[model samples]
Target: MVVIGSRTPTQIDQVPSAAQIVEGEQLREQTSTGVDLKTALGKLVPGLDFGPQGRTNAGQNMRGRSVQVLIDGVSMNNSRSLSRQFDSIDPFNIERVEVLSGASSLYGGGATGGIINIITKTGEAGGPSWESAAGVTTGFNNSNDFDHRVAQSASGGNDFVTGRIGVAYADNGRHYDAKGDEIFPDIAQSDLQGNRSIDILGNLTFRLSEEQTLDLKAQLYESGYEGDHGVYFPNLDSSTPNLEDAEIRKGFSADREPLTDRRMLNVNYHHANVFGQDLYLQAYHREEESSFHPFPYPDSDGSYYFTTSKQNTTLSGLKMLMSSDITGNVSLDYGVDIDREEFDATQMYFDDDTTDATGGLVHEEERVEPRYPGFQIDGLSAFVQSEWQPTDNWTFGAGIRRQHMDVAIDDFQPSGQSLAEGGKSDYDVTLYNVSALYDFENGHQAWTSYSEGFDLPDPSKYYGHPGQSVSDNPLDGIKTRQVELGWRYQGSRWLTQAAAYYSWSNTTIEPDDNLNIVQRDDKRRDYGLEASATRFLGDHWQFGGTLHALRSEQKIDGEWEKRGITVDPYPSQHTATLHAQWSDMTRSLRLQANRSWDYADYQGDEIEGNTTLDLIGSQRTDFGKISLGVENLTDEQYSTPWGQRAAGFYSPRFGPEYLYDYQGRGRTYTLSWSLEY
Candidate 1:
């Protein structure tokens, strides 16, 4: 494997001077759980958190701050909500996952946490390859599903052009309630509640000459969800026979369908001069849209009602990079990036007078309008980094960046009342990092670093409430100070890594008791230790495991609150993924098993934790590859991070009764197949 960056190329399997790489085999091993990129990295990296299932819209919090996600060096984060879900792309098309852990303001804004770069498959010149796969499976609950995927690529000519294209699709089935658990009759009758996705990607690379090259790429993604919400509730007491009238059970049947559409285009150029200096230029554009509909209620006139919400966002950027070797042992990289984003949202209400509450009359006109104020943000940043290698086994690195930002909000009202004129804010900040690594005997290395990071206030926070005057106080950005210490050991048959890190953040963003608007000035601290090891047990078996322990604290208004606050909800203690796989043991058979445990954590008023087991077996041959697997083998119950909202409880609400929880899928099984030519 070769590691390529905006500036230079580095060797793999060695202590990299300034870049990171993961081999293709490592990517395949990590993607055993279908196509969940986030979960695939949980065992390979520390200080990365993955939220529970059902919270599909939640973003990833890296090192206690929201991180930026990219594909082939192009940013892919949503401009409006900043959601960072890995489901946007299929894992089957990925070649590797490169994570630049720690503050990286030099790359771009919104990377206060870190940077995740996804590298896709590429076709080699003078080579041709193609692959296709299709399969079906059934499990204990409603786990019967189908999947199909295909990819093809061809390259020729020594220097003219090379291109590749790939596509994938997946349809998943829902899981049933565990034994002894009562199924929600209304939901049981609805369509399957699972995810369906389609992905399309294309790339073309042209070598203009020996000193220059051009690359163009595009991607399209669509995903959908069917059926009712996953949560459930028991019947009310006999005194409340109108239990049917309770907010939780008001509807005899409920269902919803949400969809997302995304498109991206990027173009890049690289040039090298006879003087050994290198330069790069890149321009990109992205657009995304999401629509959600909530099931409407039946009115007295026997009519059904529904509400529709949609968000549209667009982002575009250009970047320039240059690098050169100043001295025999010193090198420098400098770059500048500029970007802009625009966001808009709309909500619509619809009613059907076909049926009544008990066949009663329902009459209302469909009202559609903008749901939030429209906004735009423009930013510019420049940075420089230096690497010095004074000895064969010692290296040092340092980097700093300055960023300027301007945000504009158009005149608009959230509710249909008076218009609130838009406003603008400007900010300039600086960030820096320094690190050193020392190589020891036997391919081992120790490293340490100090980094500074910051997160800009989200644009949604700038709007004023209907009754109060819009406050002039701009949203305060969060500042982070981080310290890290770690070591890595690589051997012929084993690989191990251990790291410990602590981060302190000031002016962290949090919602008040009412959860109406976001506020800053809160303080949060997180410290954690993690270790992972992978070993080849004999010639046919491979084993690996990861263990982590973390502690967090938050201070509100100068007072420390250890519990009952909705700040940093990650579990303080957890053990993930102990797995063993036996491959090529027999003619064409492989067996694998894994176990994981999570400690209780609070999400608002609900506590969640669970232990899960999984098993898999597969057969391979010239015809194709087939595999079967089971997940959540114990049928453990759990709730996701942003699962539910309490009924009629808007602001300052507390207690379990006032909390709504999202439910997780039970035990499930899957069968898959793949063919290559």
Candidate 2:
């Protein structure tokens, strides 16, 4: 979604100038590593890819595409774009993170490989206030392996009214790595940081007079882990045959439940002069769901045993925007979007496991009837952007958008499955953009951009098993094209920035697991290079870093090629991260280092790459803050090229193997304590 904003200001400086900002003191300085939001944007954004399990990052990817994930403006990329939506929320309830790269989304389908809003926590500034936080993380010779969290908040107001409320809880366990072993159990995105959570949110603002204002919000997040030590790896049955010696099991007859429950609600209306423009109205609703447990393979042979794969989405939207000033240089930003979605997608099978992988239990449970019918969407959009400045640092921008969609499906066949015929699909698209900005009196700033993006397919491939017809399916929509160049400099202690990009897309979908379906790859493409620098060595050292270099190709034979996992697996393409710090006003220290990118798997063999370290510390104690973190500070244990890429189950008796290549999180630690009352 793109915004020209009328309100909803979480200070990302109204992003634009291409985009990228992950502040809030860089996510409150990690606050003890596993506050998972895709592991705090894979340790502070840079392209993206997270898999080393601190629990779950779903199916990480960003650069290889599919990136949308918002909070505060709702939309956790549901009906496909699931990277489990980064576990819905929780990264100390963020307060910044705006990244927008590639097919620059300014309001169009789920931003193709870009857009991660996330802005939470709105409080403070005297008056009535309260905050209480807690933490206790583990892994370092496993102190009974742990993770415990707690949070509470409150805020008050005046000048009309204002409000805020918050709640949080966590209690994970078992994550030993760093040679302490015990991580095994990534049962397909079920690691849920060992699961157990609850989060709540609230906000209110009503200043209905002085130029108008009305805001209300609500959020709820739930996590799960109905247990029996979840752990699985059984998609096997291509005649086994070695299959990389597969074996890592658990829960063989019912005893797993990994879950995620998300909810959101919002209503906004603002005005600072509506007749002349500057009004913004919004209505939002979101309901995201996630579930897992695909265990099946315990003597009974060939796939069959307590299955459960759920996905449910429900997003409702309404946005009305306006911004003005169309003279003396021009300015405008317009918007209109109305969305509705409802997807079901389920796969549940349970005739009652016979309990076999140790956890003994033999019995009878029954209930089976879930043949994925999912799909029921409706969308409409409108956009207009214009910003021109005649002098003083020059600037120019242009925009266009028009999208429409309607898809309906749900017929589902049960009992003796087979025969099918359930369809309906529709789409119409047109998205565009342009940008340029210049400023230089020394503190340089330069910008350049071009964009387009779209996505339609993946409503679980529109009710599955379509065979053909449905307009040749591949309506997979998904179109993206982009180009970018950026430069920045902000002196005053030292600052630097750089950007380069190119993108191409039309079709891209993957999931063959030996012909289980979903396939389409009309040659994807990508180009990258990003850079950053910072320094202030004076009042106690400080340094900053970020460097990414990607290529992500895929056209095979006719040219291109270089896209592994047969063209897209997600993770690494020359990365680099480094940060250093030393504070004042109450002790603080930080350091992080990354250096990954050297991959070749899926026959090309050679999966070697390493370099990781992290450390953080803080103290402002007097009954207040105290923190410490250490994530993979040197216990490498490699794995990142799609983690171990061999390309999971290519079939025909183990032809292309590498079912979740495992191995990645070692060395970890966390400890925290907070307060603010």
Candidate 3:
């Protein structure tokens, strides 16, 4: 398979570092269980943490750090992440996903961990074709636990023009835990349950000439949930082992739950041969609006106060790429990228007594304010990469990128504070990478690489404070250095890949006293090992497994210590998976098992570990194809690593009910049917 996350297409086996590809077919098969892309990716990619599978990707860290998300080579990342990148597109319209592990600046900021590139479907060369699919998921223990989805698409192409269009809709319901108890919505970050979503995708390509083409892509995705229950606190002094979960208060409602709305339009022009080289240009625009959960806090008078916030983001960018062949064994790729981003948040205040009398939180229009000063980032980048095959068995590559950006913040007033002046900061930096791969005659290969990555600290965190001004140049982009060594073997009946990596940086992204994201000046280190192997038992039988172990620490005072949840939210040190598959032309069956090992929290407390199982099967019939998937087959009871830490941290400050870590979901069964013509 070809790996496109590297900014250039290359053979997967030729990649010097760790990487993986999830085919669209595989994605469809996995998502048929009603899980989102985050969960599906976690099940396939080693070293990627799936977090709590909530509405937000708050804890979905890739290789112990942040990941840059993209669709068709266009970035979907904002300064603050907002953690809603996954909601920008539906899995049903994706062609494939390419993942490149480790820090990289090849495509610019937010890749401190790695890159996930979603390739959308395009028209095929032939007559018109169409597909329709429907699916339902439920925990089986409750009537309200059912979720339903439907999707349809059509693709066709001709010598001059081709296009593809798809639409998907889903009505999500409640979720259940291992004990068949209703899972409460996450009051802070939000949950995916109890929402309605719709996604629309379109792609059009025009063959301007035999050697040139133009492509246009557009997408719109929206998901929203109106809360019908209010958050209630109970068990103010419960211990960890005896903590009670938070209960939903009926007849009370939040003014608003959480919401996500995203839209994108992209155009690309390509010339297969531009003066004996390939030239590609892209122009794109994206707009996003997201609403966070309503929060309640105590006022100076001891009365309750409420606040709700929403973010609005606008992005526009242009990119150019050129590929030239210097010789039969040498090639060069160069590109320039220019982009601008505008982000701002608005918060509305509510009075407790008024909200109570109104039966829900009542928005006070006069009390609205900017949650943070609006910010705009304008960036320009230039890069060149080269690859050379010195010998038949040896390949080497090198690349460098120069980056420049200007961050401008608008003046604003924080709550209970006067206006603070905002200013602009200019940043210029250079990043480099090199790699080598040696292929042996026996289908064995070894490779090594050193790469650098850069990131922009979430500006909203620092600018939203009392001072209103941007914090002490904390926007000074984060720079990371990483080294990796990998080995791979591709034999007649087996395939294996393994890698060991170590990365470090001088600055760490963590939370401040007010629980806002901030960049701290401290040396940090992250090391990990990952491996995957697959064996072909026979024509119709195969087995595969993966293992990953990561360690994250930071220097504080004079000692090196494990990073806390506030610093590194996803601290699951070890993960393992095993699966067996049997497939024929008309039918298939698969069984998979996953385990998260017990690990010590930053407080030196042991977090319990758990394992889960999944069973999936499919059969093709004359009318359509039928598939069944059972997730969490054994109904294992466990707390996510992040959930454990959150429970410990929020319990005392807010009620012990916070100690109820969002428990893992119980066994769920999904039934789906699809037909294509």
Write down the lDDT of every candidate, Cα atoms only: 0.58, 0.66, 0.81
**Candidate 3 lDDT (Cα, whole model)?**
0.81
Clashing pairs in 2: 2-106, 2-107, 178-666, 178-667
Better of 1 and 3 by TM-score: 3
Cα deviation of 447, candidate 3, in Å: 0.8
Per-residue CA lDDT of model 1 for 288-336, tens digit only, reads 8766634333334432344456678888999888889999879898889
Give the per-residue lDDT of model 2 (tens digit) for 1-677. Answer: 23322123322222334456677656767656554666556656776654445344433566666677777666677665455766666666666767765665465676776777777876644568887878877765645477788888888887777888888888887666567766555544456545787888888888879899898889898988744454443333235412233444343334336688888898888888977878888899888777775544333354334456677788898988788888978878787888888877666655433432332222133554654666777888888878787887777778888888887766666566563455787778888888787877587778887888876656554445633334345355677888788887778788777778888885666656432346576667778877778889788888988777877776765776666553343434566788888889887888888776675633464446678778888888789988888877888776544435433433233322333445666777788777887
What's the TM-score of every candidate structure?
0.84, 0.35, 0.95
Q: Name the weakest run of 10 consecutive residues (lDDT summed) in model 2.
A: 4-13
Model 3 C-alpha lDDT per residue in residues 112-219, reported as the tens digit of each score: 789999999998878799989999999987677889999999999999999999999988888888888777666666777788889999999999999999999999
Candidate 2 whole-model C-alpha lDDT, 0 to 1: 0.66
Which has the greatest TM-score?
3
User: How many backbone clashes are present in model 1?
Assistant: 14
